[model samples]
Target chain A: PDPDAAAVQAAMARNGQLTKPPGALGRLEDLAIWMAGWQGTDRPHVDAPQVIVFAGNHGVTARGVSAFPAAVTEQMVLNFRAGGAAINQLARCFGARMDVHALSLELPTADFTIQPAMTEAELLEALQTGWDAVDPASDLLVTGEMGIGNTTSAAALAHAICGGVPADWVGRGTGVDDAGLALKAQVVAEGVALHAQARADGIEALRCLGGRELAAMAGAILRARHLRIPVLLDGFICTAAAASLDAAKPGALDHCLAAHVSAESGHAPLLAHLGKAPILSLGLRLGEGSGAALAIGVIKGAVACHSGMATFAEAGVSEG
Target chain B: PDPDAAAVQAAMARNGQLTKPPGALGRLEDLAIWMAGWQGTDRPHVDAPQVIVFAGNHGVTARGVSAFPAAVTEQMVLNFRAGGAAINQLARCFGARMDVHALSLELPTADFTIQPAMTEAELLEALQTGWDAVDPASDLLVTGEMGIGNTTSAAALAHAICGGVPADWVGRGTGVDDAGLALKAQVVAEGVALHAQARADGIEALRCLGGRELAAMAGAILRARHLRIPVLLDGFICTAAAASLDAAKPGALDHCLAAHVSAESGHAPLLAHLGKAPILSLGLRLGEGSGAALAIGVIKGAVACHSGMATFAEAGVSEG
Candidate 1:
């Protein structure tokens, strides 16, 4: 569904009369107007915001690209279920439901440096799983990922889709030392090179080089856009999914908002390619949708200001 | 009251045991530790965060230094009271109680370009009023202002305290035109020159050129520190108040956290002088304590993560 152009115009007009000087609210004013358009109402309300964490395991963990072993991925999934993860606490704080989908944790993606990460059928199943994860009643959606060593896969995919060198895209995932970072970069370069033909094709790139979690998040974002629900994107791996989705289906980001600029080195370049400006820059690198959950309240405040602030005439205040 | 160093160390120790890699949470980890220190507990909770907006009138409005008239200050106070302002909505979203203090808005401050903005007695009273406004039971406090031309007063105060020329400190308040900005700079320069001696003294400088709201905010910050409650400093004007308090008391900002960097040019310099890095940088210029109110949720999430996340041992996850 297309955003309501008329509602956006109405929001802009109402914002001009909101008792403050013109443009005093800055990016907040833009956010409110965007919400208005997305909701097809002059007064949009943030209701039933949901955060979905897609967890998977990556074969690249064998390459020592991440600080933690691949087994931590399943362990963190159990932790999310036990309500002890950062995303769980943050989701509760925002009154957003938390959904954890362990997408093939028992069967980790193939080591992309040696072979394609997944076959076409496995990639299709993962995408379908993500598409079905969205709740119809959800007014807003935020996507997060929990996969050990997936950053290496994301970096390879980003290098393939976004055309950056592996060194530029690879970062210190989970606080790796300088030597580990160098090894991670080498692994990503080899992975991208091994899948050069598949990298030329968008969907094939996910099958060849991306982890299940990244592919799932890409599917979820596409589904949310199709359902006309706004998606708040978490850090680098999630954004790499969105970047690939944009490659396959352009304009998929019309319903998405960049929650924060991740501390990861490649995230800035990815966001720059997507032409998105994040709401927060707290140097966050946590990836279980924690940044998105933290941002829910800020987005709510923007919607509240759009719907609740009195006009200058109502407040009897002189306009600038 | 000094923050509890033991609690901070304990919080840092627990952070290392979280399921993710060490320092993966970035500044969030620091924020959680700071909260623990400030609250004097290993598990600090942001239970009753409060936002107080101190509204006043600035005499410099008569010189066209601001886009809005001075009367808008009182009107905004009424708007805040009626719960129809941006701060009101943000407070509700964060579950924070909102308070509006109208500080002698009927009698605007004296024109600082010609004479002192307030007498020493008036400045003392304003400071005391702000001190008294802090709720005894509140765990966190956010300070904001609602004066149209107070930015000029704040710029003048910042210039005096931080020792920058008027051109360096003055900015477009409430979307002032280029000509209006030039006039504001000229007015601030003249005001600073007129009170050069008082400018050498911190509190005396506030009396010579600061509006009642800024003095009151300085007072509130000082009182919050004395009471051991963490203060979330708003944009330029509020930061100027914190800067002034720092100069007078030398350690007043020990309990303060910068909420965001405002669009106002003077705010960056002011924050740099105070050795503070803001959490959000949304280019917000609206000052009804909105930025601080918006940040309450982020701070709360950090605290929640610190207290609720599972340790690596608890989750059976191997640390790198």
Candidate 2:
């Protein structure tokens, strides 16, 4: 569903009446208008914001494509549940509830370098699982993922959908050294080349190269769009899933906000393709919705400005 | 005085024990340590944060150096007092108290192109006014400014302290057109040239080329440092004041944080010279401490994570 144009118009009108120079708030004014449009109201509140973290294990860890072992994914899930992770602390600070789901941690996907990551039926099931994770009462939904070697799978999937060289999409995952980074790049290249023809199709590419967690994130984004819940996307991995979802469902991005530009090499181009500008650029590469959680505060401030501040007429202030 | 090294060390050690990857929080970890060191405690809070906006008028506004007229400064002061300005909204959202001071607005400073902006005594008084605005009970101090054609004065000050050409230090202020920007650059060049000998001295440059508000912000920053209250520096105008403070005191930046890289062209080089990295890059150009207000939330989040998160031993999570 498209955003309500009349509500967007109402928001812009209200912004003009605010007792400041025109366009003084810069991107914040745009953020408020976008939120208003999505909420279909001139005054919108960020009610029941949520950060849903989907955890899965990537088979590409077998190729030594990551700095950490695959077992860290399971451990991080436990850390998130214990409210000990960065995302957990961030979610609490921003007044957002965090939900962690270990969808396929015990059953890792097939190694994409050698075979498809998952079957079509498995991909569908992962999507459904992700779709089910969304809270019906959530006004703002943020998607995050925890998976070892997932960046390699995300890179391969990005190479398929974004049609870039694997070297361009691959980056240092979990602070890999020179040799490990080169190994990751090579793995992504080989995987993309292996799934060349099937990758042209979005679902086929997701099945061939994407992880279970990524599949679920894309499903969650689509479902959020269907429910008119504004979605805030995290860094590179989440943007890759968003790109995949956009290819399959053309208007999925209209309901989403790009939270930040990651330090990873692939995020800028993907964000550019989506016609979105990130609210933050902190060189973040952690994937458990930390960037999105930080951006939620900014969004809340924008909403407060839109809804609570007095207009120029009300304040009896002169306009420029 | 320098930050407490022992407190910083304690914070870093605590971060290491947190149940996440080392450096997983990226710059947030650095922010917490910086705050802890400044506060002289392992557990630091952003208690009673305050935003003080100094308002003045520049005679240079008559030369078409800015897109807005000089009257806008006084009008903005009223807007700020009436709680309808961007800074007002942002301050309310971040839980920071907002104070607007109209110093020298009724008596505009002399045009620096032909004469010094203020007398030595006037500059000293302005600095004292800024120093007096500091709230001793507040843990955080944010400096912002409101003055028409102030960017020209800031650019001139930047050129004097940082030694750059007019074009390098000048930018479009308040949405100036190309012609207005060129005029601003020319005005800055002439002003810097007129004060060439005096410009070599830090305090002399501030008196000869800087506005009353800039001088006050510098005093505020220095006072905040003396009181060990961590300062959050706003955009180009505020950063120019910070640059002056650093030059005068040599180590005043130790207590200050750059909030964001403004859309103005001169801000990046000023920030680089201070050896500081901004927390946000939102392309914000609006003054009045809006950028600093936006950044307070990030600082609050960093503190929350530092003080409230569970350690690895406490959470029973395995370290990588």
Candidate 3:
């Protein structure tokens, strides 16, 4: 709860100075202030928005949780390299740089061994790689993910943390139908069972069964805080990553902003756990931080409200 | 449906040539194609977006249908003049210019007469004012609204045009209470009863009991079409305006795009009556074109999708 109410109050007071009316920017005003606190400044900027796409092979792909094949992950990584994926589009949208770090939590990469999440050193090494990607002077970090059947992984991570039923959490990952959803629930249940014997703690649970990308994202969020960078969490799996980080570092939620509540059922639980509210919800199930990028407008509006709005005194307008 | 299938198909083909992936721009892609047909260009721009804000006084305001005083309608117009209103903020978001015109259909402005919807000459004059404001060279026109207790007027219009119970269409307006909503419903029922005289057509019914602003907006939408300008309809009241226009001229919907749905119950009926699918729905009940302006981002995305995405030929990328 280190929201820095004084800083928030100061930001609210400063909002009247902007060209617009008081509180007209809505949730964006809150985002700018939260960003202000994260940056410990009255002015915040995305000087360096380090975007990472955490990829993993979902066990639910075996059960058909996606319209695309499990191989789309590898193919999309090549697409990312070719600047053909939605994430590549978004990277251009924010003028942000993206890194596609292949995690060996599931399938071993071309040169790396398939590392068990249970191994503390391996988890640390994966996280360190993610942390090392972000520059020390970066102002903000945004994490996005790409994976077929990733919702199953998200549901499993949420189930592990919230002790919720897998059925209540599983949803249409990339437009899965009823039978596909049922199959997804079965696979998530299996993953939960397989990882149940691992360390019951936050980082340990992630190390045991979480995707390399998710674990790395968790590490990145934590490191962002350590580096004084604001981290904007994108969509469901990203929220799961935030939850893992929150579980590891009790106050990591302080540095995290929930970008949007994905239509995914698992998203609500993670947002609730983190005590964060999404900026918008337009039935967007598209990953690649599309919802998050759309939310930047609100953030900009909030900043404008704080920086450009005219206070009653400034406008010489009568008050209630 | 004169939806130029070949043109739309060609537009879809051209979308991938812009810079992003195919369909990465989502709804914005649709907007671009729609604009291409309306503006008859592959490169469409909202260089002069004609936004008309229609204000009218609602009879349901006496029933406590709103949070602010019904007089706030007039006050909000002044607020619009002072640029202290939400719609003004929204208009700024899109860098779109707006004109707030008071129709004689509502309560009389301090300087004008309260012309009911039945007066064709007065109604035509207001519509002309809205039309005159639009540049003939404009790519698009957006119709927005501001009226206190106007929801009651809109519900009545929806019922008259779309055919629905006043109760089903009634809800909290401007922060009304349970009793206020009940009273608003009673008033709406009365208004509908009094205005039930219809000639089996939308234009006739609207003229009999519609607010001045609603009728003017309806006129603006129609005029925009005659001028080949596509209309972007805002929330509840604006939808009512569009329905009126649709009733006046069949296929009016062809010239229109529903910007966003409102939380207000009347919106669905209006949307249904006009046969439109809204682009966004964020529980927006405030009607100063904030939702429309918010949708501007989506529109920009759409235009960007159509204009910026790289074609397969250019990218040398393989498709599924």
Better of 2 and 3 by TM-score: 2
Q: What tens-digit string does per-residue lDDT give for candidate 2 at A167-264?
A: 88888867787888889889988888888886668778888999889999988998898888999999889888888877776776889999988877
Q: Compared with the true structure, what per-residue lDDT tens digits does model 3 show for residues A1-320? A: 35456666777566545433244344556667887776666655554565677665644455555666666676666666777555565555545677786665356321111223336766677688777767677666777767666677777777787777888778776666789888778766777776775436777667765666676777777777777777777888778767877777677777777767777777877788778877665555656666666665555444443444445565543442
Q: Which lDDT tens digits does candidate 1 get at residues A1-320? A: 77899999999899988877777777889999998888778887787998999998888888888887788898889999999999999999988988999998999989998889998888988899899999977878999999989888888888998896788898987888899989988998888888899776767888888989988998898888887788898899999988887788778788899999889999999988889999988888989998888989888988888789999889887786
Best candidate (score: DockQ) = 1
Q: What is the lDDT of residue B204 in candidate 2?
A: 88
TM-score of model number 2, chain B: 0.98
DockQ for each candidate?
0.79, 0.51, 0.18
RMSD of 1: 1.2
Which one wins on lDDT? 1
Residue A51 lDDT, candidate 3, scale 0-100: 67
Sort by lDDT, best first.
1, 2, 3
For candidate 2, what is the DockQ-based docking class?
Answer: medium
**Scored by Cα lDDT, where does model 3 land?**
0.65
**Positional deviation of residue B212's Cα in model 2 after best superposition, in angstroms:** 2.4
Model 3, span B28-141: residue lDDT tens: 566788887777667656656656677776554554556666655676677677876656665665567778887654443221112234566655666676666566766667
Off by over 4 Å in 1: none
